[model samples]
Target: MPDAIDVSATPSDLTLVQDEQQRTKSRELSRAPFEAPPAIPGYDLLHRLGEGSFGAVWLAREKRTGKQVAIKFYTRGQGVDWSLLSREVEKLAVLYTSRNIVGLLDVGWDHEPPYFVMEYLENGSLASRLKEGPLSASHAVRITRSVAEALVHAHGAGILHCDLKPANVLIDGNMDARLGDFGQSRLVTEMSPALGTLYFMAPEQARLDGIPDARWDVYALGALLFHMLTGAPPFRTPEAEAKLAQARTIEERLVVYQQVLEASPAPTAHRTQSGVDWRLADIVDRCLERDPQKRVANAQIVLDMLEARDNARAKRPLMVVGALGPVLFLVALYWIASTVGPRIVRTAEHELLQQALAGDAVSARILASSIETEVRIRQDELVDTADWTYVRQMIRDSHQRTKDELSQLNKGNFPDAELQLAFDKVTNHIKVLEQRLAQADRTLDESWFICDAQGRQIYRFPDAGKSLSESFHWRDYFHGRGEELDESVPHDKVSPRTKTGVSLAYLSTSSSKYKVSFATPVWDEDQKTVLGVMARGVHITDLLDQWEPQIGKEGRPDDRFLSLLETRGNRPHLLDHLRIEEALKRVGTQERGEVILRVSPAVEKALETTDRLEDYRDPIAQLDPKFDGPWLAAFYPVGNTGWTAVVQERRNLTLEPLGQMQGVLTRGALSAFLVFSVLLGVLWYFLHRASL
Candidate 1:
């Protein structure tokens, strides 16, 4: 989910056909006769589209009608009962006219390997489309619905598409689906169906011995939907497959298969982390139910659920608008202009100010909640990537080699080229890591550097511009002022919770920006003794910048009204603030270290009070011409961090509303504004929920 599988970013084998060169390469598995076409009596074989284990399917022209069509040659004629082929022909005849399915145009029983001519679809298979990465939610839903409809038709016709995967779902010129490749299909009356593609295969189907039912396709539907949303199939690992393949007996195979079934790799945790629509994820979960009896009754049930979810999402905004009407109506009729009109206006103005104050609190809460979510998400990314086997190995290999080189240098054996080569590998490895981090769902990712076990710097993104002997043994992260903790002695942590021990810091030697720097030890596979420390940080200023367009919407060009995070450290510190305003510029101009405040009434009041909005003057705000003392402030805590999103505005500027003339037009505007606050409250509720 972090790395969205968008249509333009195909991954590995899921890559779609982009050019003739790729098409040629894809046919590396194509076993279709290159020199001579299958001897179909009337149809002239054109070019091969693709081939499978059983036979090759080709594009051909009908001599009688001069119409382009696909011809499939069933080459394995040695032991396949001719009568089973005859039964398949009969089934195909019935399915040829079904909607959302590949149409069968004609059949030939007299060729060297019997051939059948079907209509040609040029676009390609779903596998090829997925090569472009994961489809969008709408496209995924539509495609699944269409395929479910096709499954319904096949199930009704007493035929089972035993193998249902992206490769079998073909697309035509219009991007409409056509369920093709019925090579593994069997009549529904069979006691047991053939094994389908393992990734999409239902658990019971792994036994290849069950009374055929519609639930088989139901499971496949879920797997297909999962693939579309998540890009990769759940638990589709070569290692798992190879283990099953290597099992020597039915008992051994069943044990391994049952393990896989119990794993039930659908609806992965990563999928949940992706923030996909819950309704869609639920549909996939239902389809992937491990117990066949507990799964959705049929493909039709899944389709019905999908459509219902879509309808509900479509009506959400309208539902929200309607729900706000009653509250607004009550506020609009609070009082009329008459004997008590002046008092009424005053009270209304009071309520309006209260609402504006509430709005400030809401805005701050939104920003805080969003930041908290970002922190948790980024931490998750850091942990997941840091724990990856290949990543750990790469880091260890580079660091271990560097340590060995340093040891040799200490013994006075100068292996200059070898040492340079070792450093070069470390540098190159860091470069690769940085590139991957760039592609990952990182926030800012200012720099990623690593230190060897001896506290010497090994790698930095900009190459550190320093010699390999440079050590960070005195830094706070490595050694700090704690007599009990032992400054020179070291310890390490490797897991998720441990990797997220981020401390605040300012960027650059000039301290022009702020960031959250996390230093966690990289360990061997067993997570024992530390091999090295990998440090990652992102400039928190970039977070403020990202919210600029939204935050600046209601404020002036100079950004008089702005939001920032304040942390209650030894004293209050502006953890991350935009430097666009005067007060911030005056306080945050330090060339080194962070700006930590000892005393500020505005900040203290906001942190202590539960009130949505309040007013206070900073003691330091009046010292300079550029600074403003009085502030219209709003505050809220961020996910138990003792950090708050604080929005501060120049006091006089925000009080303009109270200074407006008491006139008919002015009254109307105030009334309208109050009424709109009800609607705004509703909008905020939804937005906050979405952010969470």
Candidate 2:
């Protein structure tokens, strides 16, 4: 270049420099002043609604149509390119006829800053509603249904609302929902990187490389529903990046949504509206299901379920009233019988039989004048001869005499026979005197008569002389082979008897005399089979008189001692003083028949060790050989009889103590009602202020 510059090379280098300068000048000219698109003549911009990274929305009024519209301006200087504006405008135009989608009314390329006008909505967006608080279940369902319907339509139209979220849904004055912002929407046929709000994007979308599908809209809808119900979007944390990482897994996103639902309080509208059912809550839950496949396939299914729920709720009040009416009537009848019926029967028995028997001159006067007088005189004579003090001193003296005699008998290897004889004489005398005193004090009353198993009258007491032949029969001792004597049969129809001729049945012997009999079976020493029965027959008049005093003034039947008797013979007699035999007889059948199991091994062992065994309370009821009912019975081996004593009551009646506790519960319920009323008043006042 210094040596007169190779002329050809110099010329080529100058041409290259001119071409580079021309290209720089062209770029500068392209970047120079672009006037904002001339506002379509008469159209006027009012106020800005929002501004974003790519565009700004301005409320505008159309001069010709006199219509309000949202003009979205995409200024190249404001970080938007021509391509993005054109794509968004095209998507909006395509979705114009969709009821769920916002429509593009017009576009202006005449403006330096290209813009498009969309139909204006006044009620703002779902995101704004969520910011106030969670929506009620019904409102949440309604919004979700609309959004899903729009997604279904979009998906069918070969489009995906890749950026679906609460912010993209607009509510109008009538609360009608519409979707907006198709800026990020893509044709389903396109293969592109995922682009959407991180929190609302499905796991597949969060991957940044997967193809989007209808499920993408499903996941976004779930996220939006979660926000509407919980007042916060799922996976939205203060640490944005960390929260976005968690949203990558479908399971993790679902867990977040579930946690929000569990933590959220039930809606206030539900608490205030008594007629509103809880089934609406189920719809919200279904929409928010983590698995896109599990959610209603589309909005139609959700709408169908909601309609069904509404119909069910409408019928509930009438159904409840119909069911409760019959229950209340039955309860009233039971209460009357349980409380008042027993008292009436007890009063009738006392008035008719008890008073008459106690005042009867023939029976009472005979006992007072003859038998009782004889017993008292004999007792006095025995005491005069050997008072208790004298008897005690004599016993001690005889003990010493016997000991001396025994020592004398043992003096040699074989004691004197005479000394042994002397000791035996003193012991025999003492035994005889003891027997005399026991007999004198017996003082048997004539109110009832006693008999042996053989139907033999045993020293006829005053009432015992009524009859020994007709009243005391062989059938009375041995439960015979009558139709009522079947072991599998219930005592409802069968009268039980003891071998002692104590008839559980009311036997009409003489014209005005009725007897109530109680019997105990007499068994052999081995206690295997019953040999006879020991019976006590009381004049019905006298027995009723005795029971009257024990019956309290409350006038209820005394259910405590239910006297029953059964025989141990081949036929096995059964009897019940409570007169429940009629009911049992009516219920007689194989299915309802009684069953008897032998005593347990443990119980048999206990019996062997003790002569008199008393099990006051048995946990398990022993079935009668001929009756069914849980009975608390006492078995006593009377002489040689296989006899037992039974007393029973219904199980529910045993819970009398629990019934008394209802008063405390009633008071607690009253207190809770008062508290709830006060809380309701406070809530109403606050809600009124909130509405204002």
Give the winner by lDDT: 1
So what's the TM-score on candidate 1? 0.42
Clash count, candidate 2: 12
Q: How much lDDT does each candidate structure score?
A: 0.59, 0.47
> Model 1, range 1-692, lDDT digits (tens) per residue?
00011223222222211233534443443434433454576777777665543356677888898888877766644334465455546666878768788887777787677877767777777877887788877788888988999887887676777667887787888888878756556664454346555567777776634444566678888888888877777666776777776765444565676687686445564256454688888888888888763477666567668777978898888656645674554344454333456685676566545544544554565566666766666556555555655445444544545544544443334456654554455445556655675575334567666666655655555534443445555443333221112335443421112234455444444235556555666667787766556676666666556544444524363333455554534545555544423344555455323333323645565567564544544433433434445566677676644566776555555546555645655578568667667667887799899999
Q: Which stretches of candidate 2 lie over 4 Å from their true place?
A: 1-38, 77-83, 237-279, 318-692
Clash count, one per candidate: 4, 12
What TM-score goes with each of the models? 0.42, 0.37
Error of 1 at 114 (Å): 0.5
Query: What's the distance in Å from true for residue 554, model 2?
Result: 75
User: lDDT of candidate 2 vs native?
Assistant: 0.47
Q: Which 10 residues in a row give candidate 1 its minimum summed lDDT?
A: 1-10
